[model samples]
Target chain A: MRNRLVVQLVDFDLAAEYRRLCELDGAVGAVVTFCGLVRDCEQQAPIDSLTLQHYPGMTEASLGDIVASADRRWPLHGITIIHRVGELLPRDQIVFVGVASGHRAAAFQAADYLMDYLKTRAMFWKNVAHGGERQWVDCKDSDRQAAHRWSQDPKRQ
Target chain B: MIKLLFFGRLGDATYAAPEVFEASVGLTAAGVRDALSSLYPALGRALFEPQVLVSVDRVIVDWQQPLLDGCELAFLPPVTGG
Candidate 1:
């Protein structure tokens, strides 16, 4: 019935989030979704706690831009992009972006597109300070590989 | 001159971002990186090359752009999203 884009930085609430995404998809004949949560371990590093950073104004703009990109490409009934910021403990919800569309294909594509751009383009950054001494996690090459797959022209093998 | 900011571990790694910098009037984010490299010789090893991410006014800049006055520039490591 409607289209929406939601982005936020809270302690992260799961049950409420499921409700929010659920509420937005009344028109969708089919809805496919995903949720990303914080794990106890990261890249062989013990992440006792995490603090997410973002450029406030820029963060919202980046979200809007991604939403716009999706709008430009496909027709979807609803969209939800909620990413957590601030100090987060292990097992906390790191981020989630769910899309609802008329069919399975659009929903899946929208969700994948959102995640790809979020990794490459979002202004948000993560800092993992271990219990003993804090360490800043580096952006991994794998993320680049994942994001690169969405480029306009994929390298022909 | 370009004024840059820092955050999180990226800030800690650079001993925190410089409050201000006297940079060339019009330069790209690449120029900002070079300026920071020259200014903070201590970070030459960790910050040089094309690995650093630069932001203008909090938005990451795709290199090959010009810097503006009072623009807040940022040097970020490859991002692990927040």
Candidate 2:
């Protein structure tokens, strides 16, 4: 199966990416995908848009490591992770993660694992625009907690 | 010489990335951080705040890690990506 990892300024097509993964291996029976979007409000404040920034070489390397980690833990056919940068309006797609495998469990866990790692470790930063003001978003404790679980999972390790 | 990079809000405050620094032999990442903090105290305060992450040559590392000559050092603030 084909594995795709990308960071670009353009939007990602989730259906096409998932279809590509599912079609890559004929034996694949399950495909799990996650798409993160920019919401209109955060913390009860209205937001106009979000600006995402990331390191060029380092961002790619970090994402590769994350995918490799997921690959080692699961028997998977294919995986795709596409993240967008630059300014994005509300309701816009921010990231896409897809996994294909013979069973639903493997695909589901791998997709979750990939998204967890991508949240804190992917070297991306976001700035939110609200009420004519803009500010960089802070890391959430919940996100860190989510990523931390994999570290403690013996099977995942 | 070591190449230093600042990303996200750190870049905004520092106003530059890929800045160069003269590093002596046996310097550690922590040492270089202190030197940078003092050199640009404002950036130092903002960048080294709790939860900041550092990398050596693109791989995440502890501050105590030794710095190699010609290596690239990057400072990253808390990430908020999905």
Candidate 3:
């Protein structure tokens, strides 16, 4: 699979990443992308800033594993994953996941699967700056459920 | 000797990143945990928590996985990334 996995402290160009995948192969028919941003509010409180931490070596390796899992389930021609670390503010882009495939269904499903897997599998932590303090964000039950769905679905298996 | 690394909240708790431990062959990750707990009670409590995870050479592994002499073990908190 043609895949790009990047973990950096720099911002990414979403359009450029998507365009690059589209250019990689003429057979590409569909491209699906997801960009995660730091939201302004959490639990009704205004978040002042955000910081992302990661286990550097494991972060890239784990992301590659997630992309590989998506490739196993879908006919993806290309995939791009970029996650940013360091201090960030509300509305800042935190992540990007894109998939290119010969059909729309594969592109969509693979992108969705990559996001779900990355949320749980990748070794990154998020800390929110709120009310003169910073605290680590707790893992949401919904994310675990979302990632688990891929394992339980016989069609994907 | 083996390198025991900590990341995320676990790193904050220990106030250390990669702590080292002298080990013999066939020592399991659980044994290392036991040693750490004995050496640093705070780390012991934090590590024994249900959410804490262990990785051998950067890949997540069970606590029962045996530690090699020069392996790097990492303690990871629950992930919160997208």
Q: Which candidate has the highest DockQ of all?
A: 2
DockQ of each: 0.55, 0.78, 0.77
lDDT for B66 (candidate 2): 87
Candidate 2 C-alpha lDDT tens digits along A1-157: 3788899999887778977987987899999999999999988889999999998888998898999889899999988999999999999999999999999999999999999889988989999999898888888999999999988987855
lDDT of 3 by residue, A28-116 (tens): 99999899998999878999999999987888898988877887888889999999999999999999999999999999888888888
Q: Which portions of model 2 show Cα errors greater than 4 Å?
A: A153-157, B14-18
Candidate 1 vs candidate 3, lDDT winner: 3
Candidate closer to the true structure by DockQ (higher is better), 1 or 2: 2
Q: What value does DockQ give for candidate 3?
A: 0.77
**Local error of candidate 2 at residue B70 (angstroms):** 3.8
* Candidate 2 lDDT tens digits, B26-70: 898889778777777787787679888889888889888988889
- Which segments of model 1 are wrong by more than 4 Å? A1-7, A22-26, A152-157, B13-16, B23-31, B62-66
The list of candidate 3 runs beyond 4 A from truth reads B13-18
* Candidate 1: tens digits of C-alpha lDDT, residues A1-157: 3444445656545566556656774666656666777778777877788878877777788888987888777787777777888878888777877777778787888788788778877777787777666666676777778767766543310
Candidate lDDT scores, in order, read: 0.71, 0.88, 0.88
TM-score of 1: 0.81
Q: By the DockQ metric, which is better: model 2 or model 3?
A: 2
**Superior by TM-score: candidate 1 or candidate 3:** 3
Candidate 1 structure quality by residue, lDDT tens digits, B1-82: 5676765455665454577777566678776666667867765445664667667887777876787777888776666673
